[model samples]
Target chain A: MSGVAVRAGLFEQTDAGVTLLGDRCRTCDAHQFPRAGICTLCGAPDPVPVQLAATGTLWAWTWVTAPPPGYDGPVPYGFGVVELPEGLRVITRLVLDPDVAPTVGQPMRAVLDTVGTDPESGHDLVSWAFSPLDASVGL
Target chain B: MTTSEVVVAGVGIHPFGRFGDRTATDLGVVAARAALAEAGVTAREQIGITFCGTAYGGVASGHRVMSALARSGGPIVDVEAGCASGAAALMLAASAIRSGQHETVLVLGLEKMPAGVIRSSFFAPWQEQAGLTPAPAYFALRAQRLMATAQLTTRDLATVVVKNRANGVANPDAMFRTAVTVDEVLASRLICPPLHLFMLCSPNAGAAAVVLRRARPDDAGAGSVRLRAAALRSHLPGDVLGEATPLSGLAVDDIPAASTLAATAAYEEAGLGPDDLDLVECQDTDAARELLAYEELGLCGPGECGRLLRDGTTAPNGALPVNVSGGLLSKGEPLGASALGQVVELVRQLRGEAGARQVDGARVALAHTVGRGANASVTILTR
Candidate 1:
């Protein structure tokens, strides 16, 4: 597990709730994540910002005990495919109860998965993780 | 109907598995050499373009492979559409050849998943500290949402494993050649809630290639298959919203819409309907996606996919005869190569090269592949 030190994106510190983010093509009205310069839909290029919805339904997902390379983290993580209300489906690490197994169409809300920051680069990579909307974690 | 003719002259595949012996470059070179050799083309002089496919190998990976092979120094580009990388390369190669850019082009798919826990954008330093890292959680969230919205059951997904495993049993080249029973699949260790280990495709390593050009009677041999269409529809950013109407303002992020969008594009581009297809190679890295694929590819009525699977509609000899080559579930996911490898199998089957697992008289075939990025590629092939 990566140790915690301050000085990251700090986006997770805010309680704005995880809203799936994307760019809506100013020219063609298309939305996507990671913000692409090329408008993949109509090839118009230059997609402006259009914040996606916070709530979405779960599609299908798989548990990746083994992550991809360069990912230094815990084992047995829950990676989910979320169908945002925006029509964009996303894959993210989820914040769900361990006993809870979400089906095809369960309601979920987004939460910022705060990956600890690198004391070096300072580009705190934050994850937008989804939580089962029905149940709240007991703090 | 578009009459642009492009056929798969040859396809080469290296077995998918961890090879401590060689690097990804070696794997790619082997597949490329195999493809060139199979086409019986002595020189790369005839090839005008190359689209080398890889996701996690190295920077300028394609250039390195081509330069190492000493093949076509012609314009070469690398494609990284996540899981659809190979098919994306295939699409680029096909377009180049059909547009008269090159007489023959090679599409190579290769990957060497470095030994480690694969951390992606899903979980990085921030996600890990927040208790997020595994990819299955991302997919699980999707499954959870689907079950609630679609009114489906976990057993509905078991059919995917059942069908694919049965299909895989006959494939010697399959990574997991053993056929699995529903009970066995159901009993396997759970990766995500309701999703079993048997339902998941492992991270594998391998390389696959296909060389495309104008149809040559002597080359695809008397029986080789022709590439009718290679369609790639990248998801439009995050939501891939479900658009019900221009005015309703209700966007549903249903899997079928995305899949239908891609599959429809491919079928239309090829001028063939679902009925004209003899087989389907939909992505089933996990089981739930397989059911979604059934609807996305128009193989059955929505909500009736579970019924279709129960009734054997998607079995090897069933109405659509889907995934006869053992989907990613049984085949193991060397993500980069798996997509084009789907094409390789279809090309082999259409050309009477699939051997025992060959669908009796399959003249038309379709291959669809997807990744965590939700990128999709569907290619239609005919003999």
Candidate 2:
């Protein structure tokens, strides 16, 4: 079944795969995910939009057993921090098999996956997540 | 800032636990009145101003508390910085006294939180929907990194819970006063990888208050605790990986954590270093956080926190005890009251009044707290 992106302007579905949308400071070259109007580092106004890297290394990972308020996601979901080559670390969900445990420094590729269901709309909510590059199967 | 001395004339608390039907104002009034009585301030008009810290407390929280105490008509400001709310209020109150704006000020911290996991508005709606707002995931992720880099083990984490829970047994105001074994802590339900239910602190109700006044030359031998330093700092731009950062950053390791910045500023302001401290009360929202704080506060070198616990260096009877009031792990965190509760504990220890949990010869003590919005605060007290 297909799903809708949880939030618009955060990622794009291109022919190549899911690519994150971010903003890079024109003055200091600092990159930020989820986009920003101004550079957080140099305070340069009007940072330009850029496509973040599609693959990165897992910096950290955890299995969240309890769901947060207003979150209609499945319990025991995997969460992680992925460090991209552009020096930006993105907090994303991990698409992993039930038996597979994630390790740091593992290669990860961005993918759009269902994170939860919208309580009001009853529609599956999709968000950008990281999957192990070596995995032959997808969640 | 002027060189005027600001002293803590009195401190009070409303105990840390769930209080059914008791409003935040009720807790705040009880604590405030106790502090005022201890300070011998019968004339309500003598209070120059009031600063109240709260995160969950609604609009005009301080005004409601002041009105209940019949201490209205004075300037009452409410401050909020997540868990560092109380420290932020205390910092402003001390500054007012030092700047000669107010000769005497009352600082109060109170909270009445809902049950279960802490819910914060720090994250955007999308992030919350993505299952990122409960906060334990962030702490567990941090712990994962610490284990890989700092050689911290799950055993070490359990040991921290054991130590703090044992210490809580001696504290009457603490919520959880029973001690648990390391094995028991590890066997508890795993909320997240590397963290168990016992390793985390509960969000509950409580309040703490302090009376700060300009010190006089004649007050030398009256056993007053002087506020040597109250430094609050925010996260640097690239400190997304730090303790309080809710979202992404430049992910650079060069930027110092908020705790480090606050601790450095406080050490400089107080003209003291880690060696001069006799006791410490630091943020222990989770077991791993306390270990990280030891490094951030310069209490030990990097990669040495696990050793600090294994060697019993931070035990209650050890030199330079930490969290003798059982810490948030035992006392339960009320956000607003957490930092000031630490201050109240320090005052008791400095005055040789911390019953069974007293640290012998605690002349210089420090209280540190860091929380959401990437804010950190460090307060140093000397008798």
Candidate 3:
């Protein structure tokens, strides 16, 4: 079953798994996530859109117990910077149990999960997260 | 480099606490008047220009503050640089004095934050929608990494809270003047893992002001404290770990953080090293942040903060006294007013007027602040 992504142009679902999306500068080979109108590295006005790696390593992680405004996720959730093999880091949720902790340098794979159900539309608001490659995934 | 000297003649502050009924103008005008009164400078005649720093005061904040005091007809500029708004204003005023452009300028930092967790809009819409936008989450991420790499623990972090809370006891201007224990700090509700609720600063209301002037040769008996240097810097290109940076950070590590760059420039401008500092009032938005600041401000070697806190090196009477005003941890963060509050404390300490919180024989002091928009500022004062 397909659900609406929390934000467009961030990731795409495929048979293999979910892959993060970004833009790559052809002139300087710089990569930016969520794409950019202008390349931050080479000053190019337009860059090529590309899919990011499905697997990465957890660089740093934190558990946010207090939710900020505009958030609809569960309380006391985990999120962190996941370093892709191509040397780019993206901030995304670490989809794990509330009690489980993520270790730095641990392998993680992008996955699609339902963040919450829209109150008005009654549709699942899907979001991307990083799940541990070695452990059983739960959300 | 013989730079022209700019001195802080006087400072005034509206006690940092929740003022639900007061507006930013009321606090700003009161503090401005007190500073001008203490400086023996009339607002309309002696002051040449005014700079008001505020993040949420809206437009014409300077004009509103001036009009409230029945003083005007001079240029008053409003500035906003997140939490470092006051430091940015101080730097501009000092530069004007150093350039010989203006002799006397009044700088005011004021804020009246909305009650609740600060709903910062620094992150993208997607990040905020996904619950990745809380301020403590970022602090905790850094704390976790620093603990892993620097050999720090939750206990070490708790010690910083304990020290700052105890320091608050002597500061009447602080919102939390009661001392707390390490156990209480560690046992407090965790806003984020490794960061307790008590370890974080609330978004509160307050105001602080300083009067700066070019010193004269015959001003020997004056209450002026020399503004040795006021330096402001922004984050280098690849500062991924910075609070203001985008969620997707560059994986590069060669670029320095804004605080380090600002501190280096301040030391060079002041011609004084960290060893010469009698006391410091660096940013302590959280307990772990104070440890990060120790390294960024060149107070200690990297990875040595754990040992430093355990040995009481930064206590009130330790080798280096930091945050004698209880820091934002106890004062709560008033955003625009936070850095100026640090300046007020430093001025009091350098002038030997800090009472029970005084660092013995403190003749030189430093005030540092780092804020969103990747801004960092360091101001050094000497007596």
Error of 1 at A51 (Å): 12
Alpha-carbon interface RMSD of model 3?
1.7
lDDT of 1 at A24: 78
Runs of candidate 3 exceeding 4 Å displacement: A41-46, A117-122, B1-3, B220-223
- By lDDT, the candidates rank as 2, 3, 1
Per-residue CA lDDT of candidate 1, range A1-139, in tens? 1223332332232255645546777786756664557665567777886567778886655566554444544455556566676656665666666676656579877775444455566655455667778878411
- For this target, which candidate reaches the highest DockQ against the unseen true structure? 2
- Full-model lDDT, candidate 1: 0.70
Model 2, B188-254: lDDT tens per residue? 9999888999999999999999999999886677487899999999887765567555456676766
The candidate maximizing lDDT is 2
Candidate 2 Cα errors over 4 Å, as ranges: A119-122, A137-139, B1-3, B243-246
TM-score of every candidate: 0.78, 0.97, 0.95
Residue B214 displacement (Å), model 2? 0.2
Candidate 1 lDDT over residue span B191-270, tens digit each: 66767777777777889989887765454455767788788775443243221111011244433554677888998998
Give each model's whole-structure lDDT.
0.70, 0.88, 0.85
